[model samples]
Target chain A: MTESQFPQCRVVPLRMLKPETSERYLNEVVKVEGIRRMMVNGPSIPAVVPYGPARGSPNPNSNRRTIKVGDATMELRVQVGSITFEVEDAGVIEEIRKVTNAFFTQFPAQVLEGKFMKTEASLVDYCRYGPNADPSVIGLVDPRRKEAPVIIQGRK
Target chain B: MAYTPQYGPGTSIVAENRRKQMNPNYKLEKVRDVTDEDVVLILGHRAPGSAYPTAHPPLAEQQEPDCPIRKIVKPTEGAKAGDRVRYIQFADSMFNAPSQPYQRTYMEMYRFRGIDPGTLSGRQIVECRERDLEQYAKMLIETEVFDPALVSCRGATVHGHSLRLAEDGMMFDMLQRCVLKDGVVKYVKDQIGEPLDREVSVGKPMDDAWVKAHSTIFHSLAGVAFRDDKEYVEYIQRIHALRTKYGFMPKEE
Candidate 1:
């Protein structure tokens, strides 16, 4: 099936100063009606201490961790710099704005309507995974991951 | 021609600050009081009262090579003592932080001696002999160059320079090395976020007014735009023109 204007996305540029606020905002936004999918963009947090005396040591950074969003839980790889929301219709935009305003107490979101999320997987998806790749994984996967641009399929 | 020294150019307060910090003769106003021991503890190199660890034999003990340049150039205290080279790094917030990476390097080049400073996007690291670095770190901490909220002494994981500040105006430290509690900022850990035996107070962060008045970076969002300063723009253009002209062909004209 091809992508359509009916399933549009509006990227809400959230300037959440902390991970706690991002978690709260995400949890609230997921509860809003007409929401289809979500993805966050920001600087990637390294799994271990990348440099200095504690090289290779487990990072004790409290800000970088897993967060709960409604029923689903996900590990926050990046500091939730901005949240892009895929919605069913333009009507859901107002609900997103309301929820963003309520949860983002410190730094609010500046909602911008655009095609921020990828609708389909690229040529790498066909060559690497041999054309049986899942189309749903196109926008769901983290863009910053090492194997991100390589694969489109959720399964081997 | 008579000798004259010039700092940076600009009519803005940020440029003025850059000039002030770079001018060796101009006295840096001490904003806070940090003891020598506190500096040592924060550096995490050697114990407060420990003997200076040397990389080589002291200059006096070692036979001096009678080179003309060596005779003319005087060795610093640390160099004479043959202390190992150590470093102190700082990350300045983009939100009107008083001292930026390049600004800090320019200031250090003008003021300090026997040093190697590496300037990056957000952080600046100055390497020097252990004793010299300790002394320099103390001055940097005590002066207006440092603001606990807008600046961080991070050896690693220095990511908060470009990030939005915390609610209380403190720069985000993933390690949580420093905490603002009871209206004062205290370091509970070393520069690399290793737990310290006792808390070291870095004092209160400067207010918005102070930071705005002293910021070296011309952040358009923060009200001071690089385009606003005509003289600064012209200076940059002139420098670029001259560099290109000289690079393509070398002549007096």
Candidate 2:
């Protein structure tokens, strides 16, 4: 198995971000160049009560809503816990670190360098995206989810 | 000399808080005031003013069994009235919420009667007769055991205990049973995720300092570290060693 040449890092804040905070943070981070692909991950706030007696009832959560990032408008299904992204090079990580540092003044955040993104597509990915699917789209969205990944046309 | 019970073993503030909660003699400081009607609304078991739906006839109206054990153990009001069994569950945040699952179970067993507590990694559920459950639920919500932000009442989908708190410091509830508005936390939906007819205000979230001090869970980053408490570690180690040795029946040295 071969690994992707691009480096990945995750920016974890001490507190999970509200939708407004997440949008602001994303907008700021996208301003920096060399961020290839990004994903916002956290505990999901379902559109409807998923289980128990109230299953199928509408789940009205303030945290779950649509937010605009650069030229893209996407719905946020989860409370933003951490933002993970694949960058073009190691230098981009430093630029992101500076951006995160300046952004998270109210609370501390860490820019952890590791292999956070899937280097290779799994069986689930194959089933969801098919054999000739774009490598960039792999592992971006949950396989169970029918929703596709959002493309943010950033300034850079 | 008369017997006395030591609730738990620890030197840290978390341990002391745990002991305080588990000791019936140690009165929990009342932090909020949630009315009995509010609790019923949040519980979603029955209407606020409706009579308790019974599972059986009242004990007084039923024939008495000639048993010594039955004679000795007096029935609680709910039991005597034959109220249906109902439950209330709580999910506690790992970030210095006042209590944890096991701690809740232990504390409930010590302080309340006729309760069946189910303890999990992140959530605790207590089941009792509907009438008794309302009284107990009211006490749990209005006392120091509850924090409007870190602690939430969730009957199902209790998935946010170990996750990071939201930017506003409220625990993540998938159902969003409660919402923080204008410095106050209000329950817009019942514990089971059904929308409430009217919002039930449980008061504002406690400050970080108060939560840290009153918290029973030992968190390394947020609150007191478990390793910092030597006595607690020693006690746990001893128990671990004894439990392991007991299986083998080793002779005492």
Candidate 3:
């Protein structure tokens, strides 16, 4: 496997964001063109009480609700701590930085440029997708998850 | 000469706060007023007004054991009433939370009686007779030790202690047990992730300045840095050295 050709940048706010805030931020970022793929990461909020005495009980978290980003609607599994994006080039990263700077007026957020995504597919990814796996999709989402990544359509 | 016990060693404000918490003689400042019923509700051990269930018969009715220890030591109210063992656990955020797991254990041990405190990296659990536990829980919540946003009562699934705070300055709870509404933090669910009948408001979260001033945890980014306290570092190094040398029976030169 070769290194990813696209440049990656991550938006790290001082605090984890609520669903509404994350949705607003995602909508703002998605407006910036040249972004190829994006990933939201944070502590997992399961559908059920995953463990303890209340295991299997319904976990009704306000933060885990479905959010509409651009034209795509997707359920948030985690309290979004940070967002990483693979962009077309450095120009796109600068555009993202501007969006982040303008958007996070209430709280400070940093747009860091570096290798934030898995460049090569891991052993688990190889086993899950087999030999002819899409490089863009690999390591994008959890291999165990049955659902595919949601693609936010461009501005109409 | 009389020997005075020092709860901990340090010069930093965080250390002073820690010592203040551990010193039983020092009265903990009442920061907020969380009612007993609210505490009982948050504990989720029993209903707010229900009677405390017992694990054994009342001590007064039971046959007395002919032991000297029993003769001298009086049973606590809960023990005498034969109440069942119950627990209250707390997860404190790393970002200038007033209290942390080990600090909680130390404070509880120094101040409370008949408690079995289990301390972990992120959370602290204290088990005691149900009646006694309610009282302890009340103190733990109402005192300066707890912050509405930075500290949370989480019986299980306590995973947010070390994570970053939410944009609203609240810790991340997977169960979403509590919510910040109208600037007040309210518990919609009990400690163990069970939904409550009604929202129990703790209070508005303390501002950053107040939280930092009262925080017992040493956080480099938010509050006092641990390395800044030279005496604490030296004490820790000495203890570490002693423990390492114990196998070889090392003596001080």
- List each candidate's DockQ score: 0.34, 0.89, 0.89
Candidate 1, residues A63-130: lDDT per residue as tens digits?
67776666555777675567777788888988887776676565556777777866777677556655
Checking candidate 2 for backbone clashes, the offending pairs are none
lDDT of 3 by residue, B15-86 (tens): 999999999999999989999999999999898889889999999999987999999888889999999999
Q: What tens-digit string does per-residue lDDT give for candidate 2 at B1-253? A: 9989998898889999999999999888999999888999999999989999999999999998899988999888899999999999999999999989999999999988888999999899999999889989999999999999999999999999998888889998899889999999999999999999999999999998999899998889888999999999999999999999899998879
lDDT of 2 by residue, A37-118 (tens): 8988898888988889999999988888999999899999888999998999999999999999999999999999999888
Candidate 2 chain B least-lDDT 10 residues? B163-172
lDDT of 1 by residue, B1-253 (tens): 9977778789988889999999999999999999988888888888889999999999999999789999988999999999999999999989999899999999999999999999999899999999899989999999999998888899888888888666567776666678787988988778986767888999998888898998889999974999999999999999999999888887666
Pairs of colliding residues, candidate 1 = none
The residue pairs in collision within model 3 are none
Q: Could you give me the TM-score of model 3 versus the true structure?
A: 0.95
In terms of lDDT, model 1 sits at 0.79
Order by TM-score, highest first: 2, 3, 1
